[model samples]
Target: RSYPTTTDEEDPDSNLNATCPEYFRWIHEDLRPWAYTGITLDMVERAKATANFRLVVLNGTAYLEQYQKAFQTRDVFTLWGILQLLRKYPGKLPDLDLMFDCVDWPVIKSIDYGGPNATTPPPLFRYCKDNETLDIVFPDWSFWGWPEIRVKSWVPLLNDLMEGNQRMGWDEREPHAYWKGNPEVAETRQDLLKCNVSDQQDWGARVFAQDWKKESKAGYKTSNLADQCVHRFKIYVEGSAWSVSEKYILACDSVTLLVQPRYFDFFTRSLKPLQHYWPIKPNDKCRSIKHAVDWGNTHQQE
Candidate 1:
């Protein structure tokens, strides 16, 4: 478990802190003959080899907005999720690429938005032109299109919300939450509506509604869950689950999503909805989400 140490007795922590800036400045600053030492042909070869799992990191809200699951824009914490995956598979994954929409670039790089802090554009995106290049399929990254009304971060707090719902005398014994995609989008919204939810109380639990469609730029009312007496979520997401990635947004929030695990690999997490991995259809030519998750997780544990 231990790594080899250098006998040079300089304080490792302080030395690293002191030298890293110099090293970075030397690499980034101009007027250097050998500035490209870190990058080489072997790295390129390795990166190409890793292209099988192309990792596309978004610079900010804009890149994700393209897919229609605007929920991806809210929090910066999701970046750590990518780092965790990379740590799990160091060499197997292609080098992470950074990309942002042409419009958001200025705002992201602007000084007012903590231009120098982590919010600033990631350097890797600048170097690597390939981003949002991963072909993997993933949907339902969260419960609702909106992260704010989605799953509470802490598990205990989540239980509280559920308990509160129960205390309100709304089917405390068997409570159910429903997650629906865009009314217009296919594979998610339309199919979500297909699932029968007519009964007020189905399977002994009260049925709740979840929508993942986003509010139009023209502005739309937030989730009407507050107005409703029932305990449900207001997820405003729309578009193709495979194409738009709203389904994975639902999965990210520990919501019990309803979907035929079509493209779950790219966003599979601990808390996911109904998974229909392989056998995606009667003519299913799909792989098992459980298998892929296990495979990825096995490598991570190893």
Candidate 2:
């Protein structure tokens, strides 16, 4: 998480020589549509329908034009994330204004803007987007911390998970694939719970329902993200549009049983199906999950 900084004493070019990561290509891809016709104020105004707020960054200072309040502290943390970016790279970001929506589903459908007589696509920033959408994707607010859930920031939480992983070798971990999250938010997640071990069937998966209210009452001991790496495989399924649990599931030092996702975040485009995770079929979720776990149980070296 440490960033390389250039001081007046050192040549700025020294740090510039390092190549940008490949995942940065997505940023270019997101903005490519507007590259030809630049973002106009009119285009910005067009996005107001779905935007929770308009963020204007001019001369290193930021201003917010709130249209509607987002759920909980989403807008607050989202703006905080932007301010952190402005602070991390001072005097580097250009003067710009953009619309931000904190909703789960992306609204700017490609079908709407792809017709021959269609108007220019309005630029919008959101948490996640599908391939059929034109919305620019950004990292979720949980990157800073999910305070309500008592989850720490990304770097420290990742360090804690790594330490937890070291305590138990992958081979020594539980043979069953594991998943624990709220199933009520999406039917897909509710369907996943059916794959769990039962008297009639054992799907090689262990799934638990996350009771945030109960967890909060218990001081979040059983719900700690760092302590959930006890299994050799972990499941990640999208809730609503996309869940913020993808990174955490991948960080567990275990094979990931990733349910096929319709929406993607800023960095998930770089993940390969078989290379990064075992893709679980949405239609045949139970059987697909069982197959992935069985494959992992047999192919331990992979």
Candidate 3:
């Protein structure tokens, strides 16, 4: 399969150096464990218990050693992305062997490997990691596409969100905060759902449980990411781990009520709370969400 490549003629500014995102600095720290020792085959093997697959790139060709089938098609698309990179940049990529875990949580805790008897940390790539783990974060498979859930690739979906934002300006949206996702995956989310309006209280939050089975039967019309941009504020609460819903909510042009997350993905480190999102306390979710919506409503210009 052929992939698109940029031409200098197509964009004269292609040669200009652009500032890298702040998170790029963390690459050094992420690779620190292996900087002196270097990653060995034994280190790669150590990660197999938690890794779904082992990938090797040698001489512009790719090989995979699957330990097990990843949940849904996560491993499928992840390997597809690597193959595309090989095609996109021919001989630029180095020969390397790596372990990739498709699961939500990072398993290699840094605390486990930090003592006099500590062994060199095995390098493991995964979707998200907490500050306590040494797992290297990579972009999740949802970026390319999440066909099982009907979420399109990042670029096209982002285009749809931009169009959605234009359709309903921020001032024209509903005044309450909005969030829609499965609450069954995490108790934190179940707690968040309690913030939704009820007969006894209206927390200024409109949270909805996403019944994927029901939505699948109905062709996901109600769950369309673009259509979710009707609220002035959007809420982002972590499910099992760091969620893939983050970029979608932030792109909605609504004030994002970000519930404090324990884990983070590849790019979220660059996001600043007050500038990019309004922080919501996970423990006191109802009150925090209420305050965010109210504050955004009051500070319309900001």
Q: Which predicted model would earn the best TM-score? A: 3
After superposing candidate 3 on the true structure, give the runs of residues whose Cα lies further than 4 Å from its correct spot.
1-14
- List TM-score per model, in order: 0.31, 0.93, 0.94
lDDT-wise, the better of 1 and 2 is: 2
Report the poorest 10 consecutive residues by lDDT, candidate 1.
101-110
lDDT tens readout by residue for model 3, 72-108? 9999888878876776666668898989999998899
Candidate 2: lDDT of 9? Answer: 43
Clashing pairs in 3: none
The number of clashing residue pairs in model 1 is 29
The deviation in Å at residue 153 for candidate 2 is 1.2
Candidate 1 vs candidate 3: the TM-score winner is: 3
Give the Cα lDDT of each candidate.
Answer: 0.31, 0.88, 0.88
Error of 3 at 35 (Å): 2.5
lDDT of 1 by residue, 15-125 (tens): 434544322332333112113344444533333322212235332211221222223443233433444444444343444343222111111122322333522122212
Cand. 2 TM to true fold: 0.93
Sorted by TM-score, highest first, which candidate order results?
3, 2, 1
- Say which prediction, candidate 1 or candidate 2, comes out ahead on TM-score: 2
